[model samples]
Target: MMKYSTSPTPSTSSYPRSTSPLPAPANYQPTTASAAVKRYKYLRRLFKFNQMDFEFAAWQMVYLFVAPQKVFRNFNYRKHTKSQFARDDPAFLVLLSVWLFLSSMFFALCIGLSSGQIALFVLFVVFVDFIGAGILVSTIFWYVSNKYLSVDGAGGDVEWGYAFDVHINAFFPPLSLLHCFQILLFHNLLSHSGFLACFVSNTFWLASIVYYLYITFLGYSNLPMIKNARAFLLPLPALFVLYVGTLLANWNLSHMLMDFYHYRVL
Candidate 1:
């Protein structure tokens, strides 16, 4: 006791002594820290992508880029990949079409073409937009088709078959409009007061989009096999409804424009 009092008390190491004696499971696997982390992260991603059973790596990469982060941020990616990916919602298409149509009309009338020549000019703008849409859609289809064929051994050509699915939503239409809008803005800046010129340009844009949608639909839908038959047919009913809706919307928008103009004058 006298000798111990002279020296400092010995400290215990970090390791703890367990009083309970529990046997370790016989088949317990010791996972490395890095491997465990990777597994956990993968599970989170899987849960986030909603376990979309994406077969091809190309689409997976596309999803990783295009997909909204909110869809996956809370989950483990690893756990979700065990299943198949589901198709996009049909309502999303309808909503996108409506929004695109409304936006196009507004931009064409207000900025691209003057409010005075709203009708014909808007139509023209829509036409040019469609043409550009065709090119863009075709390119996307080509890229996806090539990727899909390389991986899955399906889709004969990039022309009309599987390409229809590529343009099912208002994806191409809106994208093309965005591109045309930028160029048209530049044109508007250059020729500030030439309504007729702007109208003509806008007409070309609209006509191009209409033509592309029509031709592409006819080409893909009328194909020999059941290639895009399902996708094409699905849109027909929706387009009919959209056509009627667009007329009503355009009419209402026109009235609103007139009211605003009158109010400004008053």
Candidate 2:
């Protein structure tokens, strides 16, 4: 009654009510769980395990070294259309990495290093041989492929990662053989039969080298960019050159390491 001429009271229903939820603020952040889930999914897909069968993949990997031609023929590069930037089988790459690591450890163990020293040696091999050398060789192959091979008219392009994939796949057989020879040599399994040991080790080494050359040749020959045999053979000389250069570069370091092992552990 104080203000007798009262207007309608400004009640809670005076303004309109929103049916939709409010928009997230500009500074809004996702929950940690949500982010982790997304990362896990991404990693799984990237590694190609989402679509791969473990047993089949393992068999195929073994076949890659044993029956390379059959494996190569079965390989369909076009299937990896999603990997326009980087085309490689993540499973194969991972297997190769693991093999490298295990081979390094085996060598270190054969040298009779202490546990701590073996661990360090394995780390060195993983970092220097696997990571560093892999990157260097892959880069070289990529450059050679793009520069020399003309892919302009071809249906497919030579991606850097794909080139690396080819390089690694082609060389894997030789690497495995070489590792086997090293293991045998180090373990003295055939030490009593010196001639047999020498013959077997040399056979493995020679076969590895020959297989590497043959595989590289076959790999390049099948490329879309290389049309003629002459063009196909061009990469071979470059590969040999790179191989020799890499060996020369690492010779001193390898010798030093061997000497250290012999003096300290053997």
Top-lDDT candidate index? 2
Candidate 2 per-residue lDDT, tens place, 169-238, comes to: 7667766765545566544543333444444544455566667656655555545565342443455566
TM-score of 2: 0.61
TM-score of each: 0.28, 0.61
Number of the top-ranking candidate, with TM-score as the measure: 2
Q: Candidate 1 has what TM-score?
A: 0.28
Question: Which 10-residue window in model 2 sums to the lowest lDDT?
Answer: 5-14
Candidate 2 whole-model C-alpha lDDT, 0 to 1: 0.54
Tens-place lDDT per residue, model 1, 1-266, is: 22222111222223232212234345544333343454455445544442333323223223322341212211111112211111222232333345556665665555435565566544543454444564576566556434433333432334331253335422444344443443355444423335444444444444444534553444333222224433433455565565456444433322343344334333
RMSD of each predicted structure? 21.4, 20.2
Candidates' C-alpha lDDT: 0.38, 0.54
